[model samples]
Target: MSDPDLLAKLFQGDPRSIARSITKVESGSEGAAELMKAVFPRTGNAIVIGITGAPGAGKSSLVDKLALYYKDQGEKVGIVCIDPSSPFSGGAILGDRIRMATLGMDKNVFIRSMATRGNLGGLSRATVDAVSILDAAGFDKVIVETVGVGQDEVEIVKTADVSVVVLVPGMGDDIQAIKAGIMEIGDVFVINKADREGVIRTQKELEALLGLAHRPDMWMPPIVRTVATESKGIEDLSAAITSYFDFQKAETGALKFWSDALGLENVHTEIVEDQKVRVAMLPIGESRIELLEPTSEDSPISKFLEKRGGGIHHIAVEVDDITASLAKLKSQGMRLIDEEPRIGAEGCLVAFVHPAATNGVLLELVQTND
Candidate 1:
């Protein structure tokens, strides 16, 4: 079948299609990159919960119980368990589907077991690809259960939206966690096997350790106790997850631009008559959004305002010399919107190439003054 048909089936929650697509992506198949590109925009919707702890921390049990909790809430759940690869076979050692026998059988749940494949942080790029596929497949919650407190596991957990660290009583896991830098990454802490002898002691120690570190987000990680075997405290765990999600949504702070993604150049708020126009300098090569509310109905950006309200007005590329670039384009018999450069927001010298010349994409070339 073609990719579009396969993609449609995957989106329709066809178990076979999702399993096949995931396998192809995991195996580094020829067209997997294109599939992932189509899947990306559909992601960022599912709540990605990463569970990590030392080996034998009962992470699998906790994941099984927590997934069941989400499933009970009428949510479509996706579970990806990253197991250690055998040095000889390079396959996942513990098949998570076996442990999660009941969940694996549920039509609303999709469970996948992936081998770390000797990749760094125990999370291969394929694992990320699989998670994206599940997210696109309309899973409400995607749980990633990874073993060990190694640097690779920590790195894997860091990619999650909510990182959950599991601990057991009397394991001396506190010291190991600090050593592995797990203290900084955990958004929620769980002391699984809570019915054990030293449950309170472990909780106290975790609280004490948390007191020492100050998070920039200022979110005080909640410590939850769970007895996964008895399905105890699973409700509390689910509640903690919901609470964190609510907190993040209520948080309105400075917009953060990641160093690897985009940079911020300026922030200016303007009032054009009654409506407000906010100019945020995204500084991603040279693309920008312009919002306008003109006194007259015949404003320049009125067409865009009429279409889909408003969004990115044009795509801009940074050029060393706008005049020279435009001259080069004109020599090639290309159509231009403005032959001369003009001043834009934040004093950017810019010129626009007609969308007709750029295959229906408004292309603007810019030269930074400062």
Candidate 2:
């Protein structure tokens, strides 16, 4: 079938077509990028839940129960389980056979098992695309169960709408969770197998650790206890998930509303790879506000965030010639972060004037391609 026809079928919630589309992206088949480009706009309709933890944390069991709960509520559920790869075939060693026994039989529930495919983070490179396919295919809740590779699974934060860190009592899982740096990313923490011993102790430790965490949003992550085998606390888990999801939507809406009230028209967004920052341009009259979001932890913007939270990083002035401007500044005894013009977002040649030289304000000189 042609791409458009397949996409139409996929959008119609045709299970076979959805599987086919995911397979194409998973294999890096030709036209995969084009297919994803088409599928992108149809996404953001599904709430993507990423579940991760150490091995034997009962993550799969929790996922199965959670998915069934969503399915029972009349919402289409898509379950993507990342399993260890088979050495020779590079395919999921534990393919959907196990989950197929439970959820695969239901028309409203779609289950897919993806191989980690050598990604140490326990996620396949194409896993995000597979989730996007399911999202576009009209799944109301897409649950991504990772390979449970502990700390390495931090990549889950990037793709998931809400990140869930699953733990068990008496396994020292709380200590492991802290070591894995999972505490910071978890929007909702789950204590699965709550019937086990040391439940109270584990919860206390988790609470103490959470108390020490200082999120920029100042939102406290809720802890939900679950006994997945007996399906106890499933509703509570769902409620916690919903609460966080709704809170994020409200926060985002407030920001957009504030920007609208300020009359800042969003121009465009661009990634400056050299500095590892994503720039969002919003023009206000003659001046524009450039919001810099760090793409990596070691990036300069991230350091600024750690030290000063959120505020203006720099002010930029467009010039006719950026290189000449930098040279002139340097000759006049001005300290320059970039002695020569380097590429900034949107192909603009840019150079930075050090804060010391600019009266404690970092300044950028830009020469736009336009």
Candidate 3:
């Protein structure tokens, strides 16, 4: 809303306000940037758990049971399900699962379904924004259940605080986990449908695989058995989740202390609509650093991130006149990614130089509104 007090109402945990904010963010409509900028600081209070596995791994059942466990303990829970998109409407095929019918009735629980909308990662960009809105709205626990598209689901790591990979009691499921690279991203492994035959064999195979994988953090992931229908082992699964969360909290606190000591102030953060990116600017003396995060799979920055992990994307230089600079570069035989300067974040006119022209370094020229 144009009214500045919307954020205040959002922090008060009003469901209506939270739903409206999430809608604005999902559509990328006007004022969305302002809303998210205000929302970013109030987040980090909720624990985001990401559940992923192959199709029919009973991820939805697992999520439902886990959420009920949290709600019974007198905590507010938020659930975001990424479901397959309808080809015609581009909406979630399964808006809300019938299995969650019971949990949906609780006022303390919030449930929403997001469509992948053709995103290969099985996680739409709006999913993260939705989680942030819930976290800012004082939800104690937020659960994100992926679309369950095996390999491409690895993108869940970017948003989840603790990633749980659900598998079934079968040899085929174990091979599926390996193909999905679960060992690298899974903080906790689950063998759902423990009552099914071959449960022991699946556990032994999973344990053997875990033994082979070495985590840099040196923490051995624990395998939990779950029977979602009977709500068996739900308490044990909850305990495993808490253990990892506490471990991360301690590590994060140390990092935050060092960052504060260095005077690293997070100056400003805003979504760059034209680039489909969220940028956070930190001014360090005369030079400033901008951290870029892609909002969609088709975003140029997303391609960069997919090809190369985190690192410098490009270098930007400020020039007095962007038009003249572009003309000069064109005449000097320097390849230009942008033939003409375009409006960028903060009303700056920006243009890019191809890497080929700059000896394999992408460069951008910016002319501030001043």
Candidate 4:
């Protein structure tokens, strides 16, 4: 368990402890659960903003400037940068240290880079946990910047108190917002790099799209222009965000709906944790064996027993070299279930060991290919 004293300090707004606590949670350390238990009550105070857009829209620069703007207003900010995982390496490209260089040095600023890690949402489950940690640690605003406008990115917006959809001028897809379902979730739309040509055209198109979608709360999401690199229009963007918050507050029914939805999410998490514990405690042997008599003609095992008889059971083995070991096994007269190794959940390449080689024991082989 984490030291309760340290976790208390974090909830009491100690920045250093908060940073260390976030690291523990992000790394999935043992005591993270306890730390979160201590901090949960202190959360629901921070405003979570999710920034998502298509790739190459300069979302990172916008996030950087936006965080700086919040800090200038005397508000401590926390940022979660969700980087897409490389298909080959399964690692993120824009690591935390590289993307948030400017804000990383600030004591009031906390920045974390989260990889998709094959999570359904572009953001990891840990990203939600990390945001809660930051919120509980007394950051006034928490920002989550996602890499692209895919389905996963859209899911990230559902977790945020406010969602910002960013676009760039001259992308040549005026209807891209409609295609991405960006018009639905956006609390604020930012036309980043607004100094580029076709800025007015893009703005007009966005306005037309906004006109078509009538929100239940009668709130029209504003479209703001920004040259994020030059830091222009940042104040206007910030103001627009504030306006959304105010409008949400004024709409009591909408506010209640949002609250109820988040409440349901909390309940769902509790149920999942309960089920996990139950499954873990169940008494089940690590391995199982089935036997068949030769007289039982209907038994599937009887046919195999008659053919191979007492020859060999399938042998399950874990190997470090799946390809080379399988090749060597094949040369030694062993049959393989799969000609090529395939991915398995155990973080290894897996193949079936020939039943003939292992004296009637069905063998499964797992090997770490990476």
Top candidate, metric TM-score: 2
TM-score of each: 0.66, 0.68, 0.65, 0.62
Model 2 residue 167 distance off true place after TM-score fit, in angstroms:
0.6
RMSD of each: 12.9, 11.1, 15.4, 20.4
Instruction: Encode model 4's per-residue lDDT on 81-180: one tens digit a residue.
Output: 7754423212443455565566656667877767554444424667788889889888999998875556666777778988898888876474564444
Give lDDT tens digits, candidate 3, residues 1-370: 5446778888888777887888787777788888889999999899999888766777777888899999999999988877544232134433454534667665578777765554543245578889999999999999988744555556654478998888888856555546446667888889899989988898888888778866645458889999988999999999999999887776345335435777666577667778977676767788887777776688899999899975789999999999999999999999999999997778799999999999998999999885
Stretches of candidate 3 above 4 Å error?
1-5, 84-100, 118-123, 148-152, 173-177, 263-370
What lDDT tens digits, residue by residue, belong to model 2 across residues 4-37?
8999999998988988988888778899999999
Global CA lDDT of candidate 4, please? 0.70
Candidates' C-alpha lDDT: 0.74, 0.81, 0.78, 0.70
Model 3 earns a TM-score of 0.65
Q: Show where candidate 1 strays beyond 4 Å.
A: 84-94, 173-179, 252-370
Instruction: Provide backbone clash counts, one per model.
Output: 1, 0, 0, 12
Better of 2 and 3 by TM-score: 2
Q: In candidate 4, which residue ranges exceed 4 Å CA deviation?
A: 12-16, 27-29, 84-95, 98-100, 121-123, 172-174, 253-370
How should the candidates be ordered by TM-score, best one leading?
2, 1, 3, 4
